[model samples]
Target: MKSRMHKGVSLILGLGTACTIGLSSLEPASALPWQQLIFNGVQLLQLSNISPQQTVALGQNIHQQVKQNYRLDSNSKTNAYVNRVGQRLAKASNCSQIPFRFYVVRDSSINAFATTGGYVYVHTGLLNAVDNEDQLASVIGHEIAHICNNDLINKLKQTQLAQGAASLAGLDQSAVTAIAYQLAVDLPNSREAEFNADDKGLQYMRRAGYNPKAMPAFLRKLVRQSSAPSFLSSHPATQERISVIERKIANGR
Candidate 1:
């Protein structure tokens, strides 16, 4: 009877030890860090963990596409002027570690866009429309804020994960991909992001020795221009944004 009791106790001890070891092994490896679990049990990529090399490659790819599709002036004077202003604003941005390159598109459209890879493109019409360096800096600062916030990547990944969830729910891969692509391309930022960008852009302009109020002034001009049935009609010039900018300027002091 004593022997049997001892045997049973040993067996229990051994099983407990084995279970503990198994659980330890089941834990995910530290090297392959787990990301935030989202819908459909899909994990989103941690943007901070993303490699710089990958970002550069992505930016370069987008830059090539923009170059191919848009009409950019190759003139040295225009390029130099744009680069000078961009460099100044980029230095004041939160993501100054990333190298920034600016280009002036020859198109007359009043459009400006920033890509994930630290590339900022400004249309000739935008430059022509601005009155001074402060106005230009405000535009650049706003665009740089988008880059600093990693808004593009976040939107892209959010879209991909959403589609992935749909795919797991019996949606075809092609359909999911199509939807994801469209969402990624047309990801309008949230109101919070827009306001944050406006505030940050104001600070950036101030840091670069330009008047922060220039942002609100330029925005007002854009809002007025939007009403004229021009190419600038497609932009976000809602009164809310104007009000936000005005409030920031009012409280900034």
Candidate 2:
């Protein structure tokens, strides 16, 4: 019993770390350096325990939490526009076999995130920031890649044993809620994950008939701003990512 409790605590702490990195809107002027965050993420990745069924269940829980915690914009036209672009990219993605859903959070903070299963979220701030449909598609495509690749499931696999143990013990739903909130809103992806999303998303966009260069163009815009939005701050774009995307674009990939 003591050992299980310890494992549960450790799982929560790991999720806490994810939440802190994710809430860039509340970030201090001197946020933890990117190197440290990446190192910490790599450590968290060491724990995998979730399965396909669990992944879906976990994603549904997080999606509900997001809707409850965040105010969703109710404009039908805006929602339709986002869904249209998201559907296009989803159809073009290799993971198109899975159903995808997208929603616009009412917040003005420029950001986007994806959770387990095929859930993708876009912030109203992000929609307002982009210049055109292609740029919008770029961002949506990135989130879709995260789902398609099962990145969250891969990460949660690290905590498989702990989560299973907790469930068997019938831990309170609040604990799951807390962890789901962090996963949905606080955890940031690793550098490799970010790049992978970018690459896959770019492919999806191109296949969907959008200009691939729109990705780098949007990313470049995000990196250049003196005060980076939550997306750039949380994702922390690096020169390497930009360079890789540029190279891919130049090579006509």
Candidate 3:
């Protein structure tokens, strides 16, 4: 599926356009314009018309949901370590203006995800799985790219649009809610979005003084461990993404 695009301050098609109507009409007390309002309401608009403030709010909401669902590390040192690395990577990202916060979920699943609100969650399994700081930075950079690109917001906006359509067609709130929740959790981003994020992520790692080559190494590990049913395994490694990264590295050299 093609990712939706935001048409500056005007209403565009798909999720961005729908969010312009949904969020703006719902919160009349806010002074945000339709363009700003739509940007704030959806993750996809963050890269284009969405303002930083809206992105922060969306991140906060997603963080809260994540905290509620997963167990956060209680060890202050672990939290601090994750935050320090995350901060370094965030500063190197293209969207440096977005305040990126990182946390380690107290789960054994080897998975990490980025929220539209500039929040990144890394599972303990992933932390333990990586060999060095560069590999870890590669993972962080990838997730940061997802957030900077507003992939999550776009996914959420699409969910909201589908739910609204379902409601209009006589679907009950429960049904709409179920579908929306699934989409939000699954993040069905297109292959193009994945590839774009990988390319941008490598840039982030390189800018942060990390060994950009670690990305391919980490991906190789993921490919070898594909049979393992881990949280990180949720996103199966693909040869296409690795090939793109190799080309990027060659071009950079």
Candidate 4:
């Protein structure tokens, strides 16, 4: 399993608890035997060529269904505030060219997830976890980076391909939408994807004039917790992640 871990990538959002307990270093999560057989990790992926218009359309469909199912924060102020912060980083994004929209989920879990076409959801628990705007930006920027880099899109592509759907060429629209939500809540991504998100998120923070140190600073807080955070824990290197981000900040990246 160790040798076959880098099969397919899953940008699973809010994947419950991480398997590591008191783990000190980062290591890629070993793919399940089944995953190893069918999936290809993000590092080795050639993403689906679903058109930009199709992606946005699919995203809108997914977004609408998600809003209906998730207990979203109804406070206009909170939603507007998150949207403002998100748009700033969205502008700083390098690869994602879509109009990003941010929403607040009325949950008390320290989690956040992104899906296709520039939709980002932040948990109220995650909101309260951040000590300041910079930290919040750190979280938001990370999610934005996932969208910018098309992690979600690639995950969907991998799933479709693994199941022999290949592309969105003729699949049922609702099924594709369901997979997006399923991946967000159920899968874990590659360590490479997390590193990419951290790197790009940090860059977005800097470009948006937010303190980039907040990336590691916030992750450190999570690690100090009695239990590891799923967001940082999905990949084993919470400590290593902090070090990498700190190095980036130190080098003015």
Please provide, for model 4 over 58-173, each residue's C-alpha lDDT reduced to its tens digit, 9 standing for 90 to 100: 67877776776778888999999899999988888895578788899998878888877788899998988999999999999998887777776666555544443232333343
List lDDT for all candidates, in order: 0.61, 0.70, 0.65, 0.69
- The TM-score values for the models, in the order shown, are 0.71, 0.76, 0.73, 0.76
- Candidate 3, superposed: residue stretches over 4 Å from native: 1-48, 160-184, 229-237
lDDT of 2 by residue, 132-223 (tens): 99999999999999887777654544343333333324334444444545655676676777888989999999999999888888888887
The digit string of per-residue lDDT tens for model 3 on 1-253 reads: 1112122211212333333323322222433422333332232222235467766765665555566567889889888988888888889888999878888888776778776768788889898989998999888888899888877656545444544432333333233222323333544455666777888889988888999999888877877884653433345356666787988899993
Q: List all candidate RMSDs to the true structure.
A: 17.1, 11.0, 8.5, 10.0
> Considering lDDT, which of the candidate structures 1 and 4 is the better prediction for this target?
4
In order, how many clashes per candidate? Answer: 0, 9, 5, 9
RMSD from true fold, candidate 1: 17.1
Where is model 4 more than 4 Å wrong at Cα? 1-47, 166-171
Please give the lDDT score for candidate 4. Answer: 0.69
Span of ten consecutive residues with least summed lDDT in model 4:
1-10
CA lDDT, candidate 3, residue 219 = 78
Clash pairs, candidate 3, are 43-153, 44-153, 44-154, 59-117, 110-232
lDDT of 4 at 92: 84
